[model samples]
Target: MANVYDAEKKVTVNVLNKEFDLGLMIDSYGNTGFRLNNGVFVMGPMAIFSKSVLCWNVRTVIDITPESLSAFYLLEPKLDILVIGVGNRGDKLSPQTVEYLRSKKLGFEILPSSQACSTFNFLNSEQRYVAAAIIPPTNVALNLDEEFDAGYRRQRNLRLYEE
Candidate 1:
């Protein structure tokens, strides 16, 4: 029988044999927030650039505004794309915010937090100037807990049967 281990899964970016020192890849994310490759866990919303990460103030998609995104706009080396992680369920940005980004000539993609993390990792691996503003998913922690509990129970049952 296969052993079941209740451990946090490691998230990785597949660079396909090319090695690059892409600083600060997102290691993991949960309902609380994100964990960086360097093992630092940041709580709440955040903004991630190629080399650094910053705490973002906005909590929900509706809270996102041009003012809230000042950090991205003022980046010296302008980002090629800005990925917006709009919490658990994907939602469209406000028209005004969309216009603001377009006026700054910043390319953008809006996705659920999980997909946003993947997209950011992929683009960053390619050495593209990419950034991400992500809101922690609302339902992830509860779902993870349920799954972990179920796995633990199954493992315990297997151990009992073996004995």
Candidate 2:
């Protein structure tokens, strides 16, 4: 798991170590999102947390250009498979980066957040890891579990990274 967190509260997981926090997140249709990290995912006034602790299957997150959107690949590698969580009513995947991803032999699967929960399970079963970085308000309301509870809760909100 990510020993160092970025200012945005993002972390990198070590698949070799099999280390991750495994948190929970859900969509409007009562679907959930999960990863190794927990607590809350708050970005620009968005925050989500479950009534209890939950876990996601995120292994690690890499730093990409512009340093955003790693949330998707965090679940799987871009060159292998992908499961996209489009916003409510369905949203557009990033055409620019997506084409580049395709050029690199990445397999893209689009699904609305409305169906993210079920789709996530399917993808996991198919061994296609994915992340829903750019989701909707429903996604925000999702309850994510923070790996480092007290430590993170007290310090995660600060904008800083250890590299």
Those runs of model 2 whose alpha carbons end farther than 4 Å from true positions after fitting are: 1-67, 70-79, 126-134, 137-163
Prediction RMSDs, each to the true structure: 6.0, 13.9
Candidate lDDT (C-alpha), each: 0.76, 0.37
Runs of candidate 1 exceeding 4 Å displacement: 1-20, 141-163
lDDT of 1 by residue, 60-118 (tens): 88998989887887877788999999887756679998888889888988898878888
State the RMSD for candidate 2.
Answer: 13.9
Model 1: lDDT equals: 0.76
Q: Pick the candidate with the highest TM-score.
A: 1
Question: Candidate 2's C-alpha lDDT?
Answer: 0.37
Worst-scoring 10-residue span by lDDT in model 2: 57-66
**Best candidate (score: lDDT):** 1
TM-score: model 2 vs. ground truth: 0.38
RMSD of 1: 6.0
Each candidate structure's TM-score, on Cα atoms with residue i matched to residue i, is: 0.74, 0.38
